[model samples]
Target: MHWRQKVDYWLETLGDEDPLKIDLLKNLSNEKLMEDSFYKDLAFGTGGIRSVMGPGSNRLNVYTVRKSALGLAQYILDQDDDAKTRGVVIAYDSRHLSQEFALEAAKTIGRQGVQVYLFDELRPTPLLSFAVRHLNAYAGIIITASHNPPAYNGIKMYGQDGAQLPPAAVDSMVGYLEQIESELLIEAADEKQLKKSGLLRYIGEKVDLAYIQALRTIQLDKKAQPKDLYIVFTALHGTATKPVKKAFSALGFNDVIFVKEQSFPDGNFSTVKSPNPEDAAAFDMAIQYGKESNSDILLATDPDADRLGVAVKNDLNEYVLLTGNQMGAILIQYMLEQKKLAGNLPEDGCIIKTIVTTELASAIATNYGIKTIDTLTGFKFIAEKINEFKQFNSHTFLFGYEESYGFLIGDFVRDKDAIQAAVFISEAAAYYKNQGKSLYKILTGLFEKFGYYKEETRSIMLEGKNGAEQIERIMTSFRDEPPGTINSIPVIKIEDYFKRESLDTVTGEKAEINLPKSDVLKYKLEDGSSICIRPSGTEPKCKFYFAVKGKTAESANERLSELVKAVFNSTCDLALHSI
Candidate 1:
């Protein structure tokens, strides 16, 4: 349909409540806006749908939400009455209209006579994942945009095992979603009817207690002197505040301080420009508190509370924010070492990390004689592996992490749990503090032993209509004509995940890749370095991740600077080619 027709359809479907819709409608009459919204429907990719909060057919709003839910409803109902009875669990983060979206999904599923277990209040994505298994529900839904800015929101679908829906299932769901030709015709149950029928139930504290209890078992160094360690924490004005702080207190931490301004669950996220813990500025308030309190460490979780970010006081007594790679490495080392000492390390235990994550973790895992599996960039893949091993498990799940601030310690929650991560990091801090070593020192020791590994990620964000096209163009170029060398290191191999093969750049040899097919390209260099190119599955951006190996900390810092310059220059060159 033409953009104007889609806009007119929206205006007829949603009247005055959508000012942004109307503005987009006015712009749709122009050639520009038409090309944008009419280009394509917001993609229901690997995890589900995520987009800016707006009224276009390609954005996230009531219409999009209903369409997504309708797909899920169709998929579940098609499985027969058993699936309906099994139903779905629904939870939301603290975002604008998140609760409303969750309710809409519940009603849509309820209309199909499916049971719906909805959380009574805002909850993290991991809890929603846990509830799916806890209730033996057929599926789950999490209303969150994760670390995205306030203007964005999303819907993530999960399978019965509490992992994000796999590719085949998502494809089936999208097929069902597309069957509903127009948004105006989508159907939902009456909220009162669903409630009165007893098919829809609201849950909260019981599930929270169960989740927290499971987290306590994952604590490796539980005997650390908690009273001697001073810790600072911040939720960055999102959903993790109460639960995370509560987890810390339950772990016997006596001197943890919270950054007051960012401790509450506020949808606006007033204190920071973006609630993402990946950015250094997001911890400004927490760092200030850390300084004042003379805390040993500072911790923060993103809006949905699935990803944890940490900063520690260095030898200079200045707080240095630890990279996702750094934190993951520490957790892997500590968890494995402790498990080995306790003689509880499973003989067949394994660790998992994404293809784009730092190789230092693989080195650490290898040192402990533990196998490490590499998956695509989402935690869902990691969770999928955990689920694959649960029954008659040959390899017990040890730990899993990605370079994007997401980590999971145990199989308690299938997805990342920052509340649990915070508990483990506090325990690790206390244990190391008693030994008179800082996290920074431990990191240095790891680098010394396993070769210094440094990584940097650059995201080129293109907003609105043209931005997405630009991102697509860049990805296509990389797939078609990859670089031969980067920073004077030969591009020895190019792994095309979409094609499920690794190509030898020089000899032209091809080998199959065992992971699921994805639209990602990774180039392995001769010096044990690598780079990955992928368009953001949830956002209008393309991300380039670069990793380099060095002999020492200073050398690693120098190489990282050089690698950044080279990568940015290459990106500029690639952009010019796209233009």
Candidate 2:
């Protein structure tokens, strides 16, 4: 149908139920907004449906939510007969209309004779992953946008193993979604009737307690002194406060101070420009608190509590922010040293990282005779690796992390658990303090020992239909005509994940990459630097990653800046200052 037809149909069909939607349709002056809203259905990528929340078919609303649930229900029914009996677990974060959407999905599933397990209140994404395993549910749904602005919301689906549904399964669900013609025509089971029939259940503190218990088992040093560790923590106005505080206090870290202004759940994320922990601006309030309390370290988690960010006191007594790569390196080194000291380092132990992550991980793992496996950018690929190792019995999963501040220390939960990361980071800080060292000093020492490695990521935000096309154009241009050199350094090789081929630029030989096909490109330079480009799967942005190694920190930073500038300038006419 034409875009105008879609707009007219939606306006006529949805006028009575949603007044806000009617207001949007009546405002004919905003032709661009109307066209954007009805141009196409919201794209359900590998992760799930994420978009601005609104009334059109291309936005996240009750209709789209119900359509997704109906498709999921159909997919589950197509499985064995017991699949519906196992049912699905539903959780939501503190986004606008999150709980309402969760209920809508539950009713839609329940209408199809499938059971529903919904959370009583908002919870983190990782908790939903844990609940799937704890309840042995057939699938899971988490209603969250994971640090996006207040205008955005999303839904993420997981499989029985408590991990995001793999590529094949997501494709199947999308196929089911395609069979439905109109979102407005979908039906949902009556919420009251579903409850009366015992198909709808509410889960609460019991599961939270179970998750905390699982976290306790992953603590490396239960006997370590935590009293002297004055830590400052901030939840960034998300859903991480209660569980994080409980876990830290239970572990005997009594002096942990909470950033009061940003402690509670506020969907607007009023305190910061963006809720992303990777951005230094998000840590502004936390840093102020840290200085006032004379804290040893500062920690912050994103909206869903799946990603963690850290800052440590430097020699000048000022808090210095550590990039995700730096934090991952420190955690790997700490875990290995402690495990080896306890005489528990496994001979077949291994760590997993994404291709874009810092090579410093390999350097640290190599020192302890551990193997390192690389996967695609998403954490789901890392989770797939963990599951693969379990079946093959070749490698024991010790740790897995990405450069985006997501980490998993144990297999208790298949996704990144910032609650666990917060605890482990605090404990690691305490251990270093006892030995007369700060985390910053430890990180510097690691860089000195392992040839100073520096990494930086720049994201160019492009929103709406035109922006998406521009992003595709940028990616296709690079893929077809690869760069010969970057910042005066020769390009030694090019890895095209979408084609699953690696070309040796010097010799003109092609080799296969033993990973799933993805829309990512990487350039390997002669000086051991790497430049990778890929569109963000969850957000409307294209990211450029740069990794460079040098003999000194100053040299590495200089090289990194030059490479970043070259790439940005050569690409589309993007703002140079954005980098």
Candidate 3:
């Protein structure tokens, strides 16, 4: 059917009760708006569906959520009978309609006769992951868009292992989702009936207790004097306040101060432009609180609380935001230092990081005799590695992180856990304070010893259907005619993850890449710098990542600026045309 026909079908079939549908119908003359809204179905990728909330096939609305939930229900039913009994765990973050979406998913699954353990209120993404393991559920669903803006929301699926569903399972779920036609027609079980039938159970404190208990085991130097190390924490109007405070207080960090204005769960995220911790602007309130309290460190977590951001007082006595790479480096160093001091640093222990993350991780791990394993760009791949190593007992998983502010300290929760990270980061700060140092100083020391390493990421937003095709075209152009040099730095090697091959530009030799296939291209420069380009799996943007190593920080910064300018300039024409 044509896009216009789909739009008309939605307009004619939608119930009169939905204001969104009414508004959409009132704008029927806007052909561009209609086409953009009905051009294609919102994609259900490996991370599940994410989109702006509205009344369209491409939007995240009640109908779309119900359709996806029904698809998940069908997938669950296809499994063994025992799987249905095992059921699913549902959690939601502090996003608009997050609670509504969670309930919708539960009811939809219940309609299929599958039991569901739903959180009574909003919870972090990590808690959802933990609930899946604690309850031994067959699967989990989290209603969150992570750090996206107020206009957007999403639903992510998790496997029994408490990690995001792998590619194969996601593909199967997508197959089932495609079979769903007319989201308006998808039937959901009545909520009251689902509850009375014992298929829908509301859970809260019990699961929270279990998850908190599990987090305590990862705290190192819990006895350290946290009183001497004042800390400021902000949830950015998301869901991190409760678990973070509980964990910190449990570890005797009573000097912690919460940014009261941003502590509560607010879907609007009224405090910042974007709730993402990676953005320095998100920490403005926290930094103010930090300075007023004379705090040692300020930490912020994204809405879902799976990613953490840190700001520490630098030499000028002002709070300076640390990049995700810097924080990951500090955490790695701290975890390894404590483990080695306690004589628990296993010879086979390994650190897992995404290929796009800083090479400083590998450099630091080398000094401790700990192996560093590189995975694809998502945390699921790291979780997959943790499962793999556990099954084989070949190596112990020490820690895992990605460049996008996601970190995992232990294997207890099979996802990037900011709750666990908050506790450990606090403990690390206390340990350094007792030694007469700060996290900033420690970070600088690491840079000095490991050689200055800098990494930067740029994302070009391309919205709607035409944008996706342009993104594909850009990738194709780069793959076909790989850049010879980035800022006069020769491209010595090209790693095409999609082709599962590494080509030596110098020798024209090809080698196999053992990781799963992905639409990512990485170029290795002669000067030990690297550049990677790929479209975001969850957003309508093409991202470029650059990493450069230099003899000093200034040189690295200069080189980074040059490379960024050159890469963007090279693609300027294509980007402008696409826009």
Candidate 4:
């Protein structure tokens, strides 16, 4: 059937009582809108489903949410009777319809006779992950879209291990999801009766307290005083306000100011242009708060609170937001320093990072005799390695982080924990302040000790069907005819993750890449610069990652500029005709 037929089927089959009916009726004449809405079933990646919330096959409405829940229920049942008995933990952020969606999933699973433990209120996504492990549940689901704009919302699936579902599991779930014949006709169990049958339970402060206790264990220096380190924090209108506040206060950080305007759980995220901490614009209000309070540092977490963004005072006393790579490098140094001092630095420990993340983190780990492992760009891959380490005893897991602000520590939670990061960052800040030094000085010291390393990212957002096709074209063009040189620097080798092989541009030699296949391409420049390009895993954008190391920061920045222009200019040339 054509895309038009899909839209027509939805229009005809939808009940008059369905809320999506009116929206579909009003947009019928908008051919482009209809096409985009019905062009495909929303792409369900390994991270689970995310898309704009509206009334279409591609939109995330109650019917679509029910479809996903029904599929999950079937997948859970297929595992074993014990799997169904172990149940799923459900939580939601502050997004519009988040609670509604959560309840819908719970009801759907309950109808299938699977146990459900739903959060009593909005909570950070990390808490959802923790609940799965803490309760020994079979699976977990959190209703969130992370840092996306207000118009979007999603559901993320986690496995029994408390990590996002691995690729094979996702593939199975997708198979189950594809077999559903009618999303609208599916019925959910009555919430009241689900409770009476003991199939549904609500979780609250008890779990929160347990998670905080687990967090406290990761505090490297109990004697480190945070009283002198004034800090500013903002949840950016998501779900971190309650727990982060509790963690900070519990740790004795008394002189902290919460950004009042953005602390509320508003789905609109009215205080900023975008909710993402990676975007510097989100820090404007936090910066204002930092300046007024003369704060030493600023911290912001996304809605689900799995990712953290930090800003600190530079030499000029202007607050500067640290990139994910910069913060990761700092944490690596600080964690190792404290571990070595305490004499618990394991001789066989390892640090895990994504392929696109900075090698500076690896350099810092190497200095401590800790091996660094590189995986594809996702926290699940990092979690996979954590599981592997435990199984094989190959190496002790020390830390795991990706370049996109996602981090994991303590292993209490399988995914990123901004709460943990906020605590450890506070400890690091206070530890340095006690020595009469600032975090800025420590960052510079790292650069001085391990050469100047810098990295930058550029992305292009292509929305709707045409935009997605254009992204494929751009990727294919780069893969088929690899760039010989980027900005007058020779392309020494090309790593094609999809092909699972590396080609030496000069020698015409091919070597196998051991990692799983992904649609990613990386180039090694002769001048010690690196360039990687891949489509965003969770968004409709193509991202370019550039990294360069130099004797000084100025040289690194200049070299980075040239490499970025070379890639950006070339990509634009490819998109000009299609776009």
By lDDT, the candidates rank as 4, 3, 2, 1
lDDT of 4 by residue, 244-311 (tens): 98999888888989999999999999999999999999999999999899999999999999999999
lDDT of 3 at 56: 84
TM-score of each: 0.96, 0.97, 0.98, 0.98
lDDT of 2 by residue, 1-579 (tens): 887888778777775758646666577568877777778888766457789987677889999999999999999999998899999999999888999999999999999999899999999988999999999999999998987899999999999988988888888998999999999889898889999999999999999999989888888998898899999999999989998988887788899999999999988999899999998999999998988899999999998899999999888988888999999999999999999999999999999999999999999999999999999987888999999999999899999999999999978789888988889988899998999999999999999999899999998898877778778887887887777877778899999999999999999999999999999999999989998999888888988999999999899999898888887775543223233
The per-model lDDT (C-alpha) reads: 0.85, 0.90, 0.90, 0.91
Instruction: Give per-residue CA lDDT, model 3, range 1-579, as digits (tens).
Output: 688988878878887877877879788898877887888888875467889998788889988998888888899999999889999999999999999999988988899899999999999999999999999999999999999999999999999999999888888988998898678898889999998999999999999998888888998776677888898999999999998988887778899999999998999999799999999999999988887899989999999999999899899998998898999999999999999999999999999999999999999999999999999998899999999998999999999999988999978799998988888888898899899999999999999999999999999898888889889988888788787877777899999999999999999999999999999999999999998999999999999999999899999999999888888776532232444
Q: Is candidate 1 or candidate 3 better by TM-score?
A: 3
lDDT of 1: 0.85
- The residue-level lDDT of candidate 3 at 73 comes to 87
For candidate 1, the C-alpha RMSD (Å) to the true structure equals 1.9
Candidate 3 error regions (>4 Å) = 571-579
Writing each residue's lDDT as its tens digit, candidate 1 over 1-579 gives 766677667777776767766676567657765566555688876457877777677878877888888888889989978898999999999999999999998988888788899999999888988889888999999999888888888999999999898888988987897788986577888888889999899999999888888778987777666798898888887788778866877778879898888888887898899898898999898888887888889999998999999998777888898999999999999998899999988888899999999999999999999999999988889988887887656689999999989999868788888987898988888888888888888998899899999999998888767887788888887777777877877899999999999999789999999989999998888887788889888877788898989998788778778777787766533442563
Query: How many collisions between residues are there in candidate 4?
Result: 0
Clashes of each: 0, 0, 0, 0
Q: At residue 374, what lDDT does model 4 achieve? A: 98
